[model samples]
Structure formats: structure tokens, C-alpha cells
Target: MIEQEQAAGLNRQQQEYLDVQGYLLLEGVLSPSEAVQYRQQLLALAAQEPGRINPTQHVRWLVNKGADYRKLLLHPAVDPWFRHLLGDDYALSTLTSNVVRPGAPDGRYHTDFQDRVPEPLPEFPLTANSLWLLDEFTPENGGTRLVPGSHRWRRRPPPDLAVHPDEIRIAAPAGSVLLFNGGVWHSSGANTTDRERVCLICFCLRSFMKPQFDFVHYLSDEAYAEATPELKRLYGFTAWPQPVDEPAAPKRRL
Candidate 1:
């Protein structure tokens, strides 16, 4: 869904869509049964331990729930998109499973590159998000809210009431991944449902900075002690030394 194209020319389609729309929705990225299982496990876990949510605000854990959640994290369809979007010189990383339970307060819209960027407002984005829907994301549910194409505007995220009125909603089936640039101003929509709306949002960067979640610390000693190299790498380990000698990339403007 996000891989770049290489034919001795610019990736006209992805580049154009990203430049104008700010986000690309990939439908049917996950099947019905797959969505069911993903939702089931996540809801069960969320119920078993309500504390698993974000300590500060949302609830979340970094564990291998099942095949549906694991496989999609490193799916082939997304590979091409990442390859083109973030050059080969980079790597893909996932934080602990991000479980935002129902009733969690709506999140403020902030740039994902705030710390990295020298300026508070950069023209373009350095970070992107892959939000994997575990349950049906409805406009009413705590579906992630975004101001489409705000990535280029370089403006502050508006309050929810101002951008999305009660009538306008964003929902997607289970298994779908909403990919967008971090610079795009957005927020977490309030969950109006009785049940929880779970998700595993991965903030993949260009392999040059520290991960938001320290995968090594989150994974229990027993879990990481016997993990495979592939698993370790996915959790933030690297087989070789990473490069950081080059200067930071230029910022994009609206």
C-alpha cells in the first residue's frame, strides 16, 4: 500500500496522492474472519486487564496476540510501499501493541517529528503511522480522526468539534490499515460505543532514532530471552550497525 516506485522517474501516483490528500486508505487489507479473530483477542485482553492501556491515557500492551495481528505487521503488500516511501537504507519498527480502549479521551493532534525537527513546524513530515484496525472503526467509534491533506498545510490540529461534527464519521472494517504522514494534523476520535475499539498503531521511522516504546524492556525477560533474531529485529534489535552520519532530510511544505 505504501511502497515507492522506481522506473528512473518520480513515483507519480503515491507522491501525488500523498502531496494532495495526505492519507491513502487501503481497503480489504484484512479478511473478515481475520478481523474477527483480531477483535476477539484484543477485546478479551483489554477486559482481562484494564491496566494494559496507556498508563498516561490510552491502554496498550506489546505482546504477540495471535497470527492476524502479527502477520499484518510485516505483510508483503505493505513492503513495497515502505520500500519506496522510506528508502532501503532504513528499517521498520513496531511499538508494543497500542490498545486504546473505549472512553479514552480524544488525543490532541501533534506532529510525530516534533523532537527530531529543529523547528516546531516543518513543511513536510518525517514520521508516518500505520493504524491496524482490530475492530470495526466507525465514525462513531473511536476511529482515528484526521484532517485530510493537512500534512501539507503545516497548521495546528483543530479541536474535534471544529473539524468533525457529530454527523461526519470515519469507519473501516477490521484488517484495514490507514496509512498517513505524521505531519498531517489529526486526533483520536472519542469512542462512543460500549465495547472497546482496539488498534496496533506502528510509527515506522527511518531507523535513525530511539523507538517510542523500548521493545526490549516491554517484552518480559522470559519472552525476550528465547526470542529469535527476526523477532528481536522487529522489536528494535539490529544485525548490523546503523548509519547516522548523514544530515537529516529536508522538510516539506504545504
Candidate 2:
């Protein structure tokens, strides 16, 4: 049961849509200029490690890269919704950009977390994914495809059901934001266009799960020292054990 007031970031209609569809597309959350800037930054980061770019997967952990990337972690438009769905103690598990080049192979349909674990898919939202589209998403450009309500499905998608009738491709302008539960069935469409398709994906999870990246060790000391309390917590520094007498709020060094 979603409370409209508790989900103030989303209206009743939007909340209902997410409840039924398992995902939501908030169009034009980032301005065109911001989109271009993000695309440039992400591509530049990719250029730094050109050899690492793989056909099906081209991702780089970016929370500690630059101020721009760090600021994106707490973007006003999508952060509230993540907190609402994942709770205040949720962790920003991984922040990486996906670079899908022209002619890249189709992404196999699957959930982010469910496939990693055994059968009897877990109930409830243990993790969530927020995608920031840096380029316009279209069929020719490899827009993402999702099975509308499959997030609630108890079983993994069978191979025979790969071409699901209920699946829909998301086509939106640059700067749009796409968010979904980790259990939602999804895959990237094949990129047949001449240009590259870029998207920043933020994988968030309940604090209890292990994060994909080690933020505490990898994050720059300077950045960690200046980060806000909330950002610090999201980076996992505050997630480790703490004294019983200490207040829940993170303060001082661990």
C-alpha cells in the first residue's frame, strides 16, 4: 500500500503507475544542457579506459571520479523517490554509466538482482535502479525494453518467454530519468543507429546487502571529508558496526 503523502516526490497517478508497471519514466527531469554535459563527462571517463569497453557491458564506477559525478548521485529530481522506496538507511550500491555502442548486441532480458541469487525470488523491494538517459532513447538507438509488471513475478523469465508480449520499449528524449525495482525484468534494445547510446545507472539497495563497489576504500579522502552527512552514509562508511550508545546518525570517524 503506497501512501500518497509518503511518496510526495510522485503524484497519486504516478505512484499507481509504478505500483502496476514496476517502473516509471520521469521525462525531461534533466535539462538538455545537463544531458549534454553528462554525456560528455561520461564519454570522457570512458575514453580514459578505452581498452575496458566491452560490447555488451561498458560500465565504470564513478562516485569518486569528479564533482559532477558526485553531484549527480544526489540529483534532486530522483533522489527523493529512491529514499521513499528504499528507506532512509538504503545504500547507493553502485553508480556507473552504460555505454552502448552502435551495433552492440541485444541485452538479455533479466532482473538486476534476482538472477544472481537462487530460485524463489525474494519479495519486496530490496534494490532499485535509477537510469539517467544522456542521449535520446529510441528503438534504433537501443532504448531499454521492460516487461511491465514482471517485477512481482515469482519465477525467473523462461527462455521461451524472451519475446514477451507485454514488454514495451521506453522511448524518451535526452535527459529523461527511468527508475524501476531491481526485480523488474528489463534489457537494453540493440543499437542499430550510427550514434552511441549512453545512460548512467545508479543501483541502490537496502543497507543490509553488499554493495557492488567499495566506496569506503576507493573514495578520495578529500571528497569523503567534504561530503554531506547523507552522502557519507550512502557511500557505505556509516554502514559498518557502531557502538550501541552512539546515536544512529553518523558522526565522527568509524
| Per-candidate TM-score against the hidden true structure | 0.71, 0.89
Give me candidate 1's TM-score against the actual structure: 0.71
Question: Model 2 reaches what TM-score against the true structure?
Answer: 0.89
Number of backbone collisions per candidate: 13, 0
Worst 10 residues of 2 by lDDT: 1-10
Clashes of 1: 13
Cα lDDT tens digits, model 2, 119-141, are: 66777777889889999999778
Task: Give the range of the ten consecutive residues with the poorest summed lDDT in model 1.
Answer: 55-64
The TM-score leader among the candidates is 2
lDDT on C-alpha atoms for all candidate structures: 0.60, 0.81
Which segments of candidate 2 are over 4 A away from where they belong? Answer: 1-7, 116-118, 159-161, 242-253
lDDT of 1 at 43: 60
lDDT of 1 at 85: 50
Model 1 spans > 4 angstroms off: 1-15, 52-68, 96-105, 113-116, 120-124, 155-169, 216-234, 239-254
